[model samples]
Target: MEIQHHVSLKHYNTFGLDITASELATIEHENDISILSEVPDFSTQSLLVLGGGSNVLFSGDYAGLVLKNNILGKEVLKQNEEFVWVRLGAGENWHQVVLWSIENGWGGIENLSLIPGTVGAAPMQNIGAYGVELSSVFEYLEAFELKTGKIAQFNTTDCDFGYRYSVFKGPLKQQFIITRVILKLSKHPTFNTSYGAVAQTLEEMGVEQLTIKDISSAVIKIRQSKLPDPAVIGNAGSFFKNPIVANETLNNLKTEYTNIPSYAFDNSYSKIPAGWLIEQCQWKGYRKGSIGVHAKQALVLVNYGGAKGRELVDLSKQIQASVQSRFGIELIPEVNIV
Candidate 1:
C-alpha cells in the first residue's frame, strides 16, 4: 500500500473533474487493507474509496484520503455441466470480465458488454444493460470491512439487489470496500434480445445462429450509437435511473400524451424510459457553457472539456425539474456524487 499526498483526481473519475485529494492511497492486495488501517491518522481521516471511477462524480477537492481499489485478478473457481463459477478481483474492469466470459464460451453476460466501471461497482449498482443485470450472474462478493479490518462474504440475498441498487448502496454504503466478486455464468445461455434495440440491432447484423459474441457485438453497436464515450468526452453513462410508476399512473399520463412509451416492470408498475422522458422535455443536446445533455442520448449529461461536477449537477436538476413538471415523474440520479 502506497499513500501519496496532494494528488489530483482528474484521471480517477469518468467526468474527469480536476479535483485534488488531501491524500490518496492504492490498495493492490488484500493484505493492503490491513496495512492501510495501520497508517498514521488513518482512523480519523474521512475515507473515499474508488474503483474504476466510472459511476462517481467529484463535486470538489476531497479533504480526506481517497483509496483507489486496484486489486486485480481473475480465476475460475468451479464449474459444472450447466454453470461455471468465476472469481474476479474487485478492481478488474467489468467489461473485460464480460469479454473473458465470452472468450471462454460463457453465455450469460453477453448482453451486458461494454458497460464501464469495475467489478466491485457492478454489484453495488447492480449494473444492468440490454435486459441483463449483474444480479443475474452474481454468486456473492467478499468485502473488506473498514471498521473491523476483516473480510465478509455477502450472497445475492444479503446484497438485496434491485434495479440499479444493492445493500452496498443502501444500508452498507461506505462501511465496507468490496474486494472480490463471484459470478455464476451459464454454459448454455438464454439470450435476452427483446429489450431496447438489441433485437433490431441483431436483425441488422444478419445473425442466423445467435451466439454470445453476436449478442455482445449487437449490444455494443447499439450502445456506441447512443451513449457518448467518457474517454473522448466526459459522462457517467445514464445520469438518472428509469422511473417506475403504477399502472393507473401510466394510464392517466397516456390520456394526455398518447405517444408516451412504457414497459411492464411488473403487474402493478410500468417502467418509463428515462431518455424518452428527457427528450420529450427537450433537454436533449441542450448545451450551455461547458456542461450539457448529450445530443445522441438525452439520459447522459456531459462535460465538454472543463466542466465541473457542480455544473453537471445543476443541469441534471434542471432536466429533472422539467421532466417532473411535465410528466409528474421524478428523475433520480443513478450516478454517485461525491
Candidate 2:
C-alpha cells in the first residue's frame, strides 16, 4: 500500500473540484485491505473508500484518510445454458466492462454503456441508464469488512436495491469495501430500447434489426449528444434523482401545467423527470461564475472551469429550492457530496 499526505483531489473526481485529502492510500491488492486497517488512525479518523471518483463532489478538503480502490481484474466464474456468471474487480472502469461484455457477445449491460464510474460504485447507487439497472444483472458481491477484517458476501436481496439506492449506500455505508462484483449476463440478448431517446436514436441510426451492440451504440450516441463529457466540462451525470410523486399530485400538476411529462412508476405513483422540472424553471444553459447547469441536459450540474465544490453544492441547493417553490416537489441529489 502506498500512502501519501495532503494530496490534491482535483483530478480524482469527475466534477473537477480542487480539494485535498489529508491522507490518501491506494489499495492495489487484497492484502492492502489488512494493511489499511492497521493504520494508527484507522479507527479514530474519518475514512472514505473511493472508486473512479465519477459520482462524488468534494465540498472541501477531506479531513481524514481516503482509500482509493485500484483492485482490477475480470474473469468468467461459470456459465450455464442461459447465462454466464462473471466476476469483476471493484476498480475496473465501468465503460470498459460494458465494452468487454459487448465484445464477448454478452448481453444485459448494453443499456448502461458509457456511464462513468467503477464497478464498485455501481451497486452503491444501483447505477441505471436507458431502461436497465445494475440490479437486473447483479448476482452477488464480495467485500472486505473494515470493522472485522473479514471477507463478506452479499446477494441481491441483501442489497435491498431501490431506484438509485442500495443497502451499500444505507445500512452498510462505509462498513465494507466492495472488492468484487459477480454479474449474471444473458447468453441470449434481450434488447431494451424503451427509455429516453433510445428507440428514437436507434431508428435515426437506421437500426431495424437490433442487437446488444446496436443498443449500446445507440445509447452511447444519445448520451454523447445530451451529456457533456467530463474531460471537456466537469460534471457528475444526472445530479438529482427523478422524483416519484403520487398519481393525485400528478393529476393536480397536470391540471395547471398541462405539459408535464411523467411515467408510471407504480400503480399509485409516477416518476417526474428532474431535467424537465429544471428546464421548466429556466435553468438549462444558465451559468453563474464557474458553475452552471449544462445547456444540453438540465439534469447535469457542471464546473465550467474553476468552481469550488461548495459553490456547486450551493448552486444545486438553489436549484432544488427553485424547483420546490415552482412545483411543490423536492429534488434529491443523486451525487454524493463529501
Candidate 3:
C-alpha cells in the first residue's frame, strides 16, 4: 500500500474537476484489503472506495481517505464445453478486460465494450451497453465489509440487479468494497445486437459473420465518434439515466409530442430516452459558463475546462428542471454526485 496526503483528484475522475482528498492510498492487490483494517487511522476517518472514478463527481474537497482500488488480475476459474467462469480483480480497466476476453475468443461482454469505469463498479451500476448488461453475465462477487473488515461473497440473486441499480447501491451501499467479480460466459456464444444503432451500424458497414471482436470494435468506433474522450474533454459519459414511466403516462406524452421516442418495458411501463427529452428542450448545445451539455450527447454534461463541481451540479439541476417542465417526466442523474 502506498499512501499520500493532500492529494489532488483531478486526474482520478473523468470529470477533470479540481478536488482534493485528505489522504489517498492505493491497494495494489485484492488480498491487501484484508490488512486495511490494521492501517490504524481508518476508524477515525471516513473512507471512499474508488475504482476508475468514471461514474463519480466530487463536489468539493473530500475530508476523508480515498482508497483507490488498484488490485488487478483476471483468471478463468472453471471451464467446460458450454461455459466458463471467469474472475476479475476489482481494479481492472473495464474496456481492457472486455478486449482481453474478446481476444481470447470469449463472447459475453462484447456488446458492453468501451464503457468507462472499473470492473468493481460494473456490478454496482449493473453497467450495460449495446443491449447487454452485467447481470446477463454475472456469477458472483467477493466484497469486504467496511465495518467488520470481513470478506463476503454474493451470488447474482443477492445482487438484486434492476436496471441501473443493485444491492451494492442500496442496502449494501458504502458497507462493502467489491474486490472481485465472477462472470459466466459461453463457449458457443449467442450475439446480442438488439440495442440502438448496433444492427444499423453493422448493416451500414456491410458486415456479416460477426465475431465478438468485430462487435466490440464496432461499439468502440461508434462510441469514439459520438462521445468525447474524457482524456480530451472532461466528462462522465451519460450524466442522466433514461427514466421509466407508466405505459399510460408515455401514451399521454406521445399524444402531445408525436415524435417522442420510447421503448416498452412490459405492459405496465415504458422507458423514455432521456437524451431525447434533453434534446427536445434544446439543451444539446446549451452551455452556461464552464459547464454544458455535450453537443452530440445531450445526456452527457461536460466540463469546458476550469469548471467546479458545484457548477456542474447546478447545470445538471437546470437540465432536470427543464426536462420535467417540458415533458412531465423526472430525469434522474446517473453520475454519483459526491
Candidate 4:
C-alpha cells in the first residue's frame, strides 16, 4: 500500500476546502482492502473512506487516515426480458453511470441524472432526485467489514433505506466500506415526471414523445439552471435535508406563514422544504467573505474561494438555528461533516 502524508484534499471534496489528511491511501482494488488494517497506526487513527467526495464537508484538517475509493468497474451481471442487473464498483461516477444506462437503453436511474458522488456512497444515503430514489432500483451491495476484513452482501431490506438515510449512516457507521453496488434496471421503463419541473421542462423542451433519455436530459437541464456547477463554483449540492415535521406542526405553521409548502411524508407527518425556510429567513444569496448560501438554491452552501471548512460548518449551524427559531422545524444536514 502506498501511503502519503499531509496530502491536500481540496480537489477530493466538492466543497473545495483546502484541508489536509494526516495520511492518505488509494483503494484501487479489492486486494487493497484486505491490507488496510496493516497500514501504519491503522488501529489508532480514525479511518475515512471517500468516494467521489461530493456529499462531505470537512470541518477542518482530517486528523485521520483518508482512503480514496478508486476501485472501478461496470458490468451487467445478468439480464432477462424485463430487468437487467448491473453491478458497479464503489468508485464509479454516478452521473456517468446514468448516461451509460441511457446509452444501453436501460432505465431507472435516468431521473437521478446529474447527481454527483459514487455508486458505493449511493446505498449509504439512498441517493435520490426528481421522483425516484436508489432504493427503488437497488438490488444489493457488497462491503468489506473493517474489523473482520471480509466481504459481506446486503440486500435492499437489509439496507433499511429511508429518506436520504440508510443503516450505513447509523448502526453500521464506520464499520464497513462499501465496495460494489447492484441495481436492477428495466428494459421497458415506466417514466416518473411528476416531481418538480420535470414535466414542465420536458414540455418546454418540445418533447412530444417521452423516453428515459428525454427525462434525463430534462432533469439535467433543470439541475443545471438552478444549481451552481461545482466545477465553476464550489458546492456540495443540498447541504440540508428537508425536515419531516408532525402534521400538527405543519397546520400550526400554515395558520401563520400562510404559504408554507409541504409534501406528504406519511399519514402523521409532512416534509417541509428546507430551502423555503432558509429563503424566508433571508439567507438566499447571502454571502460573507467567500462563504455563503447559494443565491438560486438556499439548500446549497458554497465556498466562493479561500474559505475554511469550519466557516462552512458554522454557517450551516446558523441556518439550522434560524429555521428552527422561525418555523419550529429543525433542519437536518444532508452533508456528512467530518
The models' CA-based lDDT, in order, is 0.90, 0.93, 0.89, 0.93
Order the candidate numbers by TM-score, best to worst.
4, 2, 1, 3
Cα lDDT for residue 259, candidate 3: 88
lDDT computed for candidate 1: 0.90
lDDT of 4 by residue, 34-71 (tens): 88786656767799999989999999999889999988
Writing each residue's lDDT as its tens digit, candidate 2 over 156-262 gives: 99999999999988888889899999999999988897885898888889987789999999999988887899999999889999999999999999999999999
Error of 3 at 149 (Å): 1.1
Report the candidate with higher TM-score, 2 versus 3.
2
Better of 1 and 2 by lDDT: 2
Positional deviation of residue 7's Cα in model 1 after best superposition, in angstroms: 1.1
Tens-digit per-residue lDDT, 227-338, candidate 3: 9999988999989999999999988988889989888877899999899999989999888788888988998999989999998888888889999898888898888888
- Using all chains and alpha carbons, the TM-scores for the candidates as numbered come to 0.97, 0.98, 0.97, 0.98
**Residue pairs whose backbone atoms clash in candidate 4:** none
lDDT of 1 by residue, 173-197 (tens): 9899999999999999888887858
- How displaced is residue 32 in candidate 4, in Å? 0.3
How far residue 103's Cα lies from its native spot in candidate 2, in Å, is 0.9
